[model samples]
Target: MDTLFDLDEAPATDPFDPSVSRPYDLLRHDDGADYAATVTGGGSAVVCGDAERVLAAMPAGCVRAVVTSPPYWGHRDYADPAQIGHEETVFDYIERLADLFEGVRRVLADDGSLWLNIGDSYTSGGRRTRMADRNNAARTIDFRPDTPEGMKPKDLIGVPWMLAFALRERGWYLRTEVVWNKPNGQPESVRDRPTRSHEYLFLLTKSEKYFYDVDAITGPNGRRNRSIWDINTVPLAESHDAAFPPELVYTCLSHSSERGDLVLDPFLGSGTTAMVAGSMARRFFGIELNPEYVSIITRRLAGRAAA
Candidate 1:
């Protein structure tokens, strides 16, 4: 094993400071290569680029697992036009995300699985508010379609299954829609409808029989775990917005991948996937469009290394 870092030293610089330029560049050397030079532990390359372009650079059939929760349709605009979730309509958002996964399919191993978590969007009344406990703006879906085109206001757009079906049509096998039940979900003010406490995590695979370890995620009854996963929604203590809990990320990676296997998280918000992958001794490659959050990932990883 490579001893690329020791746990006792102060990091080269602070990752949380917005002033850090390409935080990884702190490790850049006189030689042409950069901190991403070696591909393990803190040196893992988390390129800040469009997911499609980034995935193109990876070797074919190399990634063992593709786990990510793309920005929900009508969600926070990472201030980048290239970001996926800010599309005009639900179907358009679905198509755009599915197309990106099409690129991902090329990089995933034949026996690998793709786990996607997406939240539903409701037709808006024009007032934008923070997402349930995630401390990010819940963007209103931009286009107002006629009644024939989409459901009326206050109706939930089925974003998760729509993308899942689209991917299934694109030749990936749709495996499961695991419900992420947030037991401590933030309260909604809508009196007309019941409060939503869950999101969907769809598992897609390149082949019929992939590398899921049923025994790894089994429940106390000694059987395979059910579809519903009761995980609470919590922000990263590092103040990362729109970040899912590390427990959720750990469960997915634990069930689907093995130690030392390569995991890919293209969205890489707050670096939860990479953090979990590192703790479990798996290699991770991540891509993020937002430079600020990339800094968060750098700092989060440094904290782990310094521990």
Candidate 2:
């Protein structure tokens, strides 16, 4: 297999420098050679690049499992045109995500599973701007897509279900929908409706019978795990705004993979997946679009290794 890991120099040994971290400046691969080589030659890696292009270049069946949360549509402007969320229409955004996950499906092992954490959004009601919330500053954006066709203002667009069914149509099995109940959910100022307190985590697989360790996630009660996961949302203090809590990643990985399995995260926001995978002794391959987040992952992984 022509693996895409390309290293130009010896891997950085200092945990602070993080040999596993690879810098992919947007679509450019010039600086990622060393990191790529480390991934191909060693166990784990974090790369900076467009998820679609990076997934396309990787060999088939390369990862044992995938756990990710891509940017939500109409959520935040990631300061990149190539970013997934912010499409002209809701359908456009869903189609783009489906297309990107097609590459993800190809690279995933046949017995592998995908744990996707996606949040829902409401139609902007033709509003062009979103004011920054005192609780979540990242909510501020200059542009929001006009109300999607056939949907009125304030209608909840079923982005998570839409993408889930879309991937099912593309041959992935729709396995389960895990409700990620957030105890510390951000407060919404809406008056009429109840405050939103949960997002959907869809479990998908390439085949009907895939690798899942039910015992790994068995609760203290010694009963079967339920679909509702009560994991709190953990936000990054700097660099990245929204990040997956370590407990969330830990739950998904424990159920889907064994120790030392290669885990893939196409949308490695805040590097939660990689960090948790490392702690569990699982190998991780992460691709992030923003270079700033890549730096954050570098320091985080280095910090973990040093500790």
**lDDT of the candidates, in the order given:** 0.71, 0.79
Q: Count the backbone clashes (under 3 Å) in each candidate.
A: 0, 6
Evaluated at residue 107, the lDDT of candidate 2 is 85
> Looking at candidate 2, what is the lDDT of residue 14?
24
Off by over 4 Å in 1: 1-43, 125-148
Estimate TM-scores for all models: 0.81, 0.87
What are the candidates' C-alpha RMSDs?
8.0, 7.6
Worst 10 residues of 1 by lDDT: 1-10
Writing each residue's lDDT as its tens digit, candidate 2 over 1-307 gives 1211111111323222234333222223444543232232246677777888787767788688999999999898889879988899979988999999999998889999999999999998888999888776778888889998899999999999999999999999999999988888888878899999999999999998999988876655788789987777766666687898888888888889876677889998788887777667677889988888887887777765555
